[model samples]
Target: MRLPRPGEPRRQFVKRFLLLAAYSRVLTADWNGTLLAEIKPPKRPTFGMMRLRLSDFPALQNDFGSVRIGTSALTANNPLGLLYPILINRATQGQFYALLSECTHAGCAVRPYSKESGACVCPCHGSRYAIDGRRTAGPAFFPLLQYPIQFDGINTLSIELPDLPHEIEGSLVRTLPGAEFRLQLRFLAFAHLEYEVVFRASKTDDWRNVQFSLTPEAPLNRSFVSGADDYLNLYVEPAAGLGFFAVTIRILPV
Candidate 1:
């Protein structure tokens, strides 16, 4: 190998360094396609997580859409995770206020009435709730919970409902006493974290591990290797999980 001659300028070195980083994607990428760039994640638990997209409910608009969700098809078992039985208030159509698609009698999903009926009919017992949430027929003694629409003045709207409420995420694990998880990572760029890792608890249903990156970018923990913020071996035995454990990488802001 020939020894190259060099008398490089400091400014030139900086420029070259910057250029290399700008082009680092092509040169330093893991060709096996196992890695992604460092990502920014949400800082809080109440961040918006939509299991069902709004495109699923096109009728909702402005602030009204913000509160109601279409979870008729979503399989998430958590009640807060499900947003079905959406309430249609006066703002949505005339003065009608009710969960338009839920049966007022047997708690079966309410079937939308044909245009001729203009009344919501229960599929189970044929009981009826009016265009509004009141009981209009047999069996259903109580009216469906009446919720109103309130505009919060922002692009987001307020939907008031009694039957379904929001779900709170499990708490984060701040104490890593012997039972902790170690992740090995190589960041392609400067990373800001949201909720980075979700480790399923092995012990039981309630056990879970969820955490947010405190720094703008996370601090890496590695053993047996000394490198940049780039490469680190993550060593962890998750607090929640049995032998057949699963993990979820949460990069998107909630």
Candidate 2:
């Protein structure tokens, strides 16, 4: 161990102090393989998560091809989307990499730069990363987070996700105006929350003011009646041109 020399610059002294602290932590901890300067805590439930299937991605069907954006439904409510986005790249046959779309620097969604380069570029601040999640350019120091992926050695694939409550997702196809849409939302037995499920006539349209509230008395199963109004009934066409609607769940603080 060596002491800092006298009359060190303030910035240099601060950097040296941080380096020593990190080194001390490394020394005290078990070294499995790779070392990290800082370890981020495990992701929480509110963060976006995905469960991707490999065959569903066309780019991965071939070897060493372009990156593809895969989306899967989130288990719970998140501002991002009902479907969580992930980046996938195939290195070779049966070898693939799955990375979160969020940039490590400013948390912007990273977009594919070029198929030949196998890199993702952040639009917010010019952060660049390889398909394997390593930071490749300036403006970002930490590597993008990677998730575990498993394949059945066939068409099916499963990606590990953060622990989230089981969600009722997808749509119900009905032809009747008074068709009832039912959703069964279950949370952790020990958890408590205020929730609302809102419906909208279209994917891009605003949700109707009629919203369902979760209550302690009967929070397990909830139902919504569609086409009860003239405005909604107008969308319930026989051709099914504009009848598509959406139900979104919003979790509120207790």
Candidate 3:
């Protein structure tokens, strides 16, 4: 994907690329790492500040030591999966750097900092980035994207993110008969968000989590669908006459 040109509308640029991706027949394998263990967000969901205590990561206590934050594992291709992973490295005592792991070359995720080389290496094409995220070697001419961090000069680091959406737009359909039914769920999903599917028998019943096996095995991406929309086909065992379902979305912490 090409970067937005200077003065170009970012949302428009992303929309255009997403539209192209929808029509493209090539299916890129997800190169992001596995999801991290669940971590509770701030008490107020609307707050966008991500707080990390330096004490939690022993690696961050020393210079050049680093840690990854977000839902997915860090890898060399498209740091973006369900969420964009933030690579945080301690530059010096009371100083740190936070960078978006996506390599500028081909949007691949850069590997973790190598103390031996004193830089992060892009496995895809051997692009090298300095500890501060500057481009140190080529194939990639631009530096890794960096986010500002506020440190208390002690043990806490605070990073602010854009306000996340509280709700997603989607429609659900149920079909099939007999012993089982198939629920087709289509929703608009932002790259920065995570989602969960829940169901209930009726209006008065409490919503319950569905089995993992029932979740969509693969997301449908086609030209007919909007670029931002995700398609899921859920196979469910019926309880009785009717059922209700919902998709809950949340922003992943940085």
Candidate 4:
């Protein structure tokens, strides 16, 4: 949750944070109630190149028209989870440009370009970006990351994305009672990965792997939703004292 220390390398910082994140736990409260733990998902993976038909988005058909492609729609290609593709024209010539939706200032997702303001605005800090993803106003100084896109002069567009690590967003909700505890973890599962839920009685106790049951009683989908996707529910019947829980993920060999 904290930023990397000064002079720390990016790779080292990420590795350290991820190692700490896997073992972090929430202290038990005084009363028997529900506790919510915020688990930050890793970054989504990139599948090299993605192809999209311009006809699929009605807004991208005209000059200056734009559309936002979210992780829900891009379950297959997984192109950075959030993208803003805009139609830019010079005189009678028209072209398409794809911009990463994350704001440069604080990493908040930027909204679609507003025709009235003619810029994409960040809801968190009011950072404004032009139709071409250039920083136009507000606190951000750097432009949005732009993906290399090629238009076929017809209805198809090809976007090339750099290879990046794959990660998913997930949440853990826990309920504590008089003599038992329950945890419900919801996350997007990928094909070449494995997940495990672990528990500990207190901060000083060692974590032990716990058994869980899938909610849908079926397979999981690629698309991720907070309450949808796949839920791993673990119930400890004779749990004593305070309980701590965490989810650990592993990338399987291809």
Candidate 5:
């Protein structure tokens, strides 16, 4: 048998091996890192939104107080689930008008319009939207956005909404009641102190020395104070009927 030439170098042999791999569709590329990873889609189907106007509503011939205008999408996502309530107003003797379906604050669901208030009030967050979904009161800063609306030649109407306004117009908050009296308590943690709590019930300084024991229920006073005020480490006690007390505490700085 004839011997093959030894002139080919080891690098040339490696190059030939790579060429064979390429021809066989084998992968040999470096994998320092990847730019993108695989991703999965949401499980449920996302339906498009629809809208309608007053003229188009009559064509549907929906019963009064028995129709929901904004929840047809729910039928697609959740068959058995009921759509949210959309309060429609009576434009004429028998016709209906679509109103803002969601509340302005926190985007929580809104209840039926209160004829007395002339606004669609949210039972949750206490946001009130007008018949046009305008923000009337509560924490919402913006009005309810309407859906795309269309009308048929007849009274039938079609409405589509892309994404309902889920964002809140503003934060939810309430006014806090002002305290009748400002008391100060200054004393050691475990020391016994004479204290009497009273409620003036009015702005006057007249105090009622209420009698009570701290073992069962510690009481607060309408006037005077006794609590460590972050500085000055000190303590003070008062008489049993001490209607109100003012004690200064001394705290040694570390």
Candidate 6:
């Protein structure tokens, strides 16, 4: 499949890419706040990702219909920390639902709404989601983004995620209480290209840019800190040639 050339606007690139992916449709947003397209999953959906070991979570063991929230265990030093306060629930024997604990409507973190109902409800607006992250109620019309799961018969449960963003806007980004942070970049090798990691402490903060080139000698990864809030954006320079990359960012606790 073809990818957007380097330097293309991120939203535009994602739009075109989503069109090309109509057959394997990835949910995305348009400016008017509408779904670009929808496709049925051919089977249980899955993606490549950093694995989180379930063995580390004893609270989830053998507890059917149980829901709990915890960090993805990705610290400032762990690129996979991009996903945090992950919601894990045991639906049945050998079955689990692991999803990002963020509201699909306004980027607010959601919490367990009701154990009996098996939903994660957003505190800001009352968007309710099922254990599988299906939006059972609105304010949030879209379902929650979930991580792929791989359970080893005995003691290891691995949460799988793509190196890329699940949804362009912060769907894969996690906000932790902190002033320090890090971002790891994994892109298709394009030695001549330069990329920028832009960010702000909050909605009102000015954007800051951290630029770097992708070279064979070493990868472009960075650590950052902001005294106010946490947020980020990625951009590719030269915008004309074919290029692709995935990044994971994590905030260090203060």
Candidate 2 per-residue lDDT, tens place, 1-254, comes to 01123243323311100000000012224111111111122256443233344444455566554343322222222213332345665666577666776777867667643455557777778888876778999698898788786666777545554432232222222333555332222221211211233344454565443333243223334343322112111111111234222222222210
- TM-scores of all candidate predictions against the true structure: 0.34, 0.43, 0.49, 0.43, 0.31, 0.40
lDDT (C-alpha) at residue 250 in model 5 = 18
Instruction: Please tell me which predicted candidate would have the highest lDDT against the true structure.
Output: 3
Q: Give the better candidate number (2 or 3) by TM-score.
A: 3
Model 1 residue 164 CA deviation (Å) reads 5.0
Q: Write model 3 residue lDDT over 183-223, tens digit each, in one string.
A: 34444554434555555777667667554233433332221
Q: Note the residue pairs that clash in candidate 3.
A: 33-73, 76-109
Model 3 regions more than 4 Å off? 1-47, 73-76, 79-82, 163-254
Worst 10 residues of 4 by lDDT: 16-25
**What local distance difference test score does each model get?**
0.33, 0.40, 0.52, 0.46, 0.33, 0.42
Give the TM-score (vs. native) of candidate 5: 0.31
Candidate 1 lDDT over 78-196, as tens digits, reads: 11222333544323432334353445555565543333465556667877766556788878887766545443333333343332222212212322554433322222121221122
Compared with the true structure, the alpha-carbon lDDT of candidate 3 equals 0.52
Name the candidate, 3 or 6, with the larger TM-score value.
3
lDDT per residue, candidate 4, 1-254, as tens digits?
12223244434322111111111011221111111122233234433445565664555566666555432222222222233222221112566667777778877767666666788788777999888889999999899888777788888766655442222222222342332223234334333335555567775676676666554232322222222334333332224445655545432211
lDDT-superior candidate, 2 or 6: 6
Off by over 4 Å in 4: 1-47, 72-92, 163-254
Q: Point out the worst 10-residue segment of candidate 2 by lDDT.
A: 16-25
Task: Rank all candidate structures by their lDDT, best first, as comma-separated numbers.
Answer: 3, 4, 6, 2, 5, 1
Of 1 and 5, which scores higher on TM-score?
1
Residue 181 lDDT (model 2): 33
The Cα error of candidate 6 at residue 210, in Å, is 28
